[model samples]
Target: MPENTERDWVLPTEIPFSELKGKDLEECVYWLLDAMGAKDLEWRIGGAGGGAADGGRDLEAHFFEPDEEGELRPQRWWVECKGRSGTVESQEVKEACNNALAYEGIDRLIIATNTQFSNPTRDWVKEWQRTFSRPRVQLWDRAHLERYLSRHP
Candidate 1:
């Protein structure tokens, strides 16, 4: 694992995303998010092998901000991890998005994938955001994850 220090920072070359499985991939995503300042993290999808019955939520984090009363309130964010190889198509993205939207109490939904997303899937997320009032959606594909690690490390 790479540390946050600049001198210690090294982009992964040995362990490709395609090689990671189950908890390994989820832990990578969790640490990445933690490095990016996400707090109150919870791993909903554990290391135990399971299917997509997790309601499109793999992890949860809280972002604190002051409300109208000037008291800090936690804005819940749900994360869904797709660590498969090849590009994630529009249908897959739509399914994840729908599952996230259907779940309650989340202020934002983040889809983190080792594989890249299709152009149509990206466009669909943009349009979906335009139509919804809450629970904003964000996609973190391979390139995005790389960039984030580079910047934060």
Candidate 2:
């Protein structure tokens, strides 16, 4: 056998999703988005062991889209990371939606969770999209996140 010169890379699929919790999960989300070319990403946590005081957005990012004049307009994205073992419920989604409303200039709100989303929550998101005109809501549950990681990696 030839001498091993290449470094081994562990894909996200090899890691146990349940093992990622709280801050770790949030950081993972940041990395995933960063790999996908999102800019101005920042974790909500300020000091050591501190969380967002507002409990709204866990991460913030911006994606630029060229306007009619060829000016890159920023689309603000607010990402909320949830690392719960159980399925994410409608109440949690509702709270995120409510909190996102308070944030001005946000173009989209993304709820990123390591767990599955409840059917009701999915339906609620659909209804919310129909009712709301601004700040589109999106869900990035386990399957969705895995798909993104697979594509980006």
Q: What is the TM-score of each candidate against the true structure?
A: 0.79, 0.87
Candidate 1: tens digits of C-alpha lDDT, residues 97-124: 7877676788988888887888888889
**Roughly what TM-score does model 2 have, to 2 decimal places?**
0.87
Off by over 4 Å in 2: 1-4, 46-55, 67-71
Best by TM-score: 2
Q: State the local distance difference test value for candidate 2.
A: 0.85
The number of the candidate with the highest lDDT is: 2
Residue 83: error of model 2 in Å? 0.5
Error of 1 at 87 (Å): 0.4
* lDDT score at residue 153, model 1, on the 0-100 scale: 60
> Model 1 shows how many backbone clashes?
0
lDDT of 2 by residue, 1-153 (tens): 999799877676775889777888888889988998899988887555645473588889899988899999999989888888899877889988987887689899999998899888899889887888668998998888888888876
CA displacement after TM-score superposition, residue 97 of candidate 1 (Å): 1.2
